[model samples]
Target: METGIRSLRRRWAAPLAALAAWTAAALPVAAIAAQNTITIVVASSPGTGPDILARTVSQQWAAKSGTAAVVDNRPGASGNIGADHVARSRPDGSTLLMAATTFATNAAVNRTLPYDPVKDFAPIALLGTGTLALAVPPSFPAETLKQFVARAKAAPGTINYGSPGNGTPQHLAMELFKQEAHIDLFHVPFKSAGGAVNDLAGGHVSAMIVPLHTIQPLVQGGKLRVLAVMSAERAPSMPQVPTFREEGYDQVQVDVWYGLLAPAGTPDAVVRKLNAEANEALKNKDVVASLAKVGIEPAGGTPARMADTLALELKRWPPVVRAANITAD
Candidate 1:
């Protein structure tokens, strides 16, 4: 046992020494450069969830550190434009990407991404996560998922579900559900989720999958009935609404998450600093309250954890896309 232990230690000694030397050599300069004005670039339109979270968090970070923090909105190309920009930015940590689900989804479906999704960015911390709710018009006979599936299967294409677009996550999730349940509901595409929800409420569309924040008020007002949530677990705001997993349709898990990342090869110290600050900011009462009011749960965690999440999402979405043959026009 002593010989075996000594042999293992000898095997690890050189790499460990090299790592320690590299870390020691990098820290002094990083410590001095860490406080320079930092800009977080968000790949979202102004007033969108990622933009709001970026602005709020940057303000809190600035106040806490006596430094300047800025949020630059770069919204376009389904969030790839901003993401690609950050992927190519310098690894000095002055520029960070305030990214959303589009980061993973784009990598999942795009055949010609300009940068390596896994190698070109350093995942910093997850900001928050939101789920979509399954809403149907009050006029629909089915109140639960089982009944809804039965009704749709019985009528074939007569029953339809509305989505913002063909290749969007909401559309793909419903398609996965349809395949699993052997139902044949028609898909009705709209310009946006809001438009689909509007028609669902007016009975023009039978049902729609929409984010919880946008539909919670309508659900509370008794305008549209929530059948189930498209999350692995139920959302906190609607704890009474069972998840599709709990309802025996386990394939409907979908969520929109916001997180921060830096160009890959960023100093490990910088990534750690950003992770610590972002997690601390999420605990602030004002920040928590603001996010909760919109149904986004704070999800701050280490860069390693965020990287694991991004990896899983990238693997999860592509099979769905191919199975459904979903392509955007």
Candidate 2:
């Protein structure tokens, strides 16, 4: 009986020890995966351009990486709130910012930001760029870019242009247009893009410079007309609409770009991994199609390219903001 019991104990001991070893090995991996779960923070409301772009890419990235990811919209202070949040988060590569052109523009216009736009975040990938279009109500007399410019020149301050608000890209773009065209137009600021678009469609406003996709429905429905796109070249989504350069306003180019960024001090390996995943996501056919629907052209590239873009925007907008006397209010 003693010999039988000893044999049974020996037999059980090896299997039990193996099971314990396996469980111990698996625990750290589970913990690492939990730590790797990413949170993409967008500094805008849920349906905005950055939010959509973040969701689209993150969905593909998570599927490819087999990791969980989510977008957290912390909209306020013209994107500063969400940006600052990511800046303050742990530099563990788990929290990222889905930054837009406003990231630089905010720094250009505001003197007291909570985080340094250049130093607080590290550029990861430039996801894409969306074109801005100059749209007018159907009743506006301008039929072509030349005609629009001529009318604005003739009327000067009598013609008004609406924007999402003061210090916005729309406001600055129109101000740049005014400078390039040598025309003066009254500036009408709205609390929101929807408000400005609704006013433009209702003919309460004379014209507006907004994302092409945002006003496409109204343009298709004959409520608004696009005179020119504010891109270096005509947008593929609306090739019929000429570019500002085509209209002979070569200096009036403003393409809104979006990128991904991580907190400063995040490991270089983590940033490289995120960039590669983002570039792969951008190459996905479904992702490309989805972005195209909203006038965003895929612009995947190395982190250096994103850094160059941010640097250029930072240099470009400060003078414009100062000249136009733009304010965040």
Find the candidate with the highest lDDT and give its number: 2
> Could you give candidate 2's per-residue lDDT for residues 263-311 as a string of tens digits?
9977676778788989999999999999998888999999999999999
* Root-mean-square deviation (CA) per prediction: 9.1, 8.6
TM-score, structure 2 vs. true: 0.89
Question: Which 10-residue window of candidate 1 scores lowest in summed lDDT?
Answer: 27-36
Writing each residue's lDDT as its tens digit, candidate 1 over 1-329 gives 99999999999999999999997768644753656588899887788778988888988888887657788889777677888899988786788999887777776667788888888999999899889878898999998888998898778889988997766667876877887788887889997667888999989989887888888888888889998988778777888999988888767788888899999878887888888989999999998998887778899978988998898888988887787777764
Give stretches of model 1 more than 4 Å off: 1-34
Question: Cα RMSD for candidate 2?
Answer: 8.6
**Model 2 score (lDDT):** 0.89
Best by TM-score: 2
Instruction: Extract clashing residue pairs from model 1.
Output: none
